[model samples]
Target: MNSIIHILQTQGNDILNSIGQHITISLVSLLIAAVIAIPLAIVLMKHKKIAEVILQITSVLQTIPSLALLGILIPIVGIGTVPSVIALVLYAVMPIFQNTYSGLTTIDSNLEEAAEAFGLSRSKKLVKIEIPLAMPMIISGLRIAMVMIIGTATLAALIGAGGLGTYILLGIETNNNALLIIGAVFSAILALIFSALIKGISKLSLKKIGIIFMAVIVLMGGYFGYKTVEKPQVSITIAGKMGSEPEILINMYKDLIENDHPNMKVSIKPNFGGTSFLYKALKSNSIDIYPEFTGTVLESLVKTNKDASHDPKATYNLAKKLLKEQENLDYLKPMKYENGYALVVKKSFAKKYNLKTVSDLIKVENKIHAGFDPDFYQLKDGYPGISKAYNLEFASTKTMESSIRYKAIANNKVNLVDGYTTDPQIEEYDLVALKDNKEFFPPYQGAPLVSEKLITEYPELKATLNKLAGKISVEDMQKMNYQVAVKHEKASKVAHDYLVSHNLLREK
Candidate 1:
């Protein structure tokens, strides 16, 4: 219950931040859409043939998936607000343009004829007669566009565009129901309020109500501006794999700093998806920091021309040298121990077969069913690599997510499973993580990677994280992992407790 409340509070703030971003994206896009759409509608009203072609084009754009459109736009516009705004504007165009055309064209020709008969000039007929009658329809279209943009705006976060989508995406990724609800509810509220205000204004005299409505909006904007200015802004971008561990780690960092540095606000932008995405975020300076493994830095990023070695210190040196010289990035001191893959078997199964190590696995390998995570099984460095290196084959193989595989092993559905060395369940379930006599897997020491610019700007930040070096033993990490993955404890709380217990955080 306490966990539920804490999650709600955190997500509420996230939603608040998201609301601002969503509004910015929606309004900016709508404004741009109106500039282009209204003019097109005007031209269409004047030319019947052109109107048909343009409307068809907009209808086609509307059919395109927002996510796909954003993907197509990413390379051209790159990431962040620009592509997001363009996508939203494209989405907003059909309704506004269609409505504007319909509203202007539908006016009884008699009304227009009367304006001309009254000696009204062309400009007067348009400004005084045509637009006024079309006002309600145009407002109606704007309202529809506003609602549509709010819903579609959630996709913006996927491409690094900041907005309320952040909370929604985070909630979905972490399975935090509270965050999801908060983001959904508040976004609904924003759309509702805008729609209602527009509806009310459409009923009143435009000349009379317009100034007052604009004044009120400006006042609200000013108040929000003041509130934002008064609060200290501490912005930190964290890049990590989009998974349970990174989510917990980022939350932990947020809680620790917020608790200790009350006056110093902190914001954590989590880039969660895959290693490649996080790496790009770091390289582009879209993210300020992220957790990385030494071996990945050495093998994947550095590509050092050296034979594979399992020694942590040796790998660390290679990673550090390559990062400094080639990438202009720095690898902070590694955490206590390496987190590598281990071939695990349930206690009962191990005892039944008298299995102890990789060599022993070969003896009973033909009898055992193996389950691997889909990614792990498919990756070049995964099961295929292990099979080639160890020269062992299983009776049957199935691919699944790691969590599902763990459950399968627990239920005796599979006799052999791949497990992370630092997984807390290894200890909890009494599973044996067999030693790799052939050293097929490489070292994976956790560390923080910072860009050269960030290192120079925040000199103390690297040292602060480095203090964690050699402190978190494999056993310690397992316990922390259990607190998050099993016990359902908030990752931030677990991380904060660990930091305070170890005297890494100053007393409040």
Candidate 2:
């Protein structure tokens, strides 16, 4: 319970900040949408057929998946808030456009005739009569659009647009339920408040726009003041895969430095999804530092065929040598243990069958159930390759999400599952990770990958992480994972305790 409270306290600021970002993105997008949609609606009313065509086009855009749309936009607009805003604005247009059209078209023809009889020109009729009467419906549409945008704006985080969605996505990826709940609750509140305010404004006299304008000004001032007061010097960006252990390690590094090295400001930028994403970010200089496995860099990137050895130290040295000579990058000293994939089964199930290794599993293969991720299953070096190498065939096979596979094994749904060697749950569940007698799986020794520029700028940074070398074994990592994954402990707390226990934090 204390952990829960601490998570809230630590992440409360992030939640609030994300809410502010979410509101800003939604409001800016809505404002742009309103400007474009309202004018289009007014013009289209005169040409009903044209209006129908344009609305149809916009409705189609709304149907496009948000993530796919963002991916399509990335090449043209690049990353950050611009593409996110554009996406949100595009999404918001249908509601605003529909509302404006409905409100304007529904106005009684008698109202137009009354204006004509009063000698009011088209402009005067629209500004004074038509708009005022249609104001309620138009505002109602804006209210709905605002709510929709608020919910959808969460997707903006995927493209590096900072918002409440960042917290929610991270929460889901890391299994941090508190962050998810907080992000959802606050975003909902913001949407409700905005909707209510729009409704209230619609009922107010014209004079109320003045009060609204003043309120916006006051809020902006306070926000700016807070930002200016808390601004830090020497901010550095640490990029890594979202929800990966590297991200957690980076966060630990940040906390250690912030408490010990006060001059440095560290911010985590989780470039989630795939390994290719991190490589691109690193090559493009969008990210300064990240944790990478030596074997991955050596085999995947460098493409060096040095006899396919399983020795991690040799792999690290070879990778470091090639990186320095070729890519002008630095591969730091490797950490204690290699985090590799292990074919595991429940202890009881393994003992019952007397299965001690991959070779042993081949004897009873037809009796076992196997589960793996689709990607892992498809990879040539994955299950198919492993199966051929070991000559094992299972009773049934299924592809599943990486997160779900562990649960499936624990629940006895699958007799064998792909397990990360360093996962703490391996210990908690008393699973038996079979030895690979053939060594089909390659080495995956953990190490920091940094640009030559970073090393030249801050020589101390490399040594900082190297100190954590040999500190975390497979068991240590598993214990940490258990704290967050099963015990429901806050990641920050787990990281903090680990750092303190190791004396990684400088003595104050």
Which has the greatest TM-score? Answer: 2
lDDT of 2: 0.77
Quote each prediction's TM-score.
0.73, 0.81
* Tens digits of lDDT, candidate 1, 61-169: 9999986787666556656678888999998999999898999999999998899899999777877888789888888888999899988888787766767676676
Off by over 4 Å in 1: 1-36, 39-87, 102-144, 156-241, 247-266, 271-277, 298-309, 339-360, 363-367, 401-437, 458-461, 485-488
Tens-digit lDDT track of model 2 for 1-508? 5645766775677657777788888877877788789889998877889989989999999999987787667656655567888998998899899989988998999888989999999988887888788888789889988999999988877766779887677667654566677678778998999999888888876457547746766775587578678876335666666554665677776776577557887776653434554565566555667788876787677756575467767777888898888788888888787778789899998889898888998788788899898877998778988899988888999999776777788888998998778776687678978888888887788877887777788888776767777778877777787776556555667777888888887433
Local error of candidate 2 at residue 486 (angstroms): 2.8
> Which TM-score value belongs to model 1?
0.73
The CA lDDT of each predicted structure is 0.75, 0.77
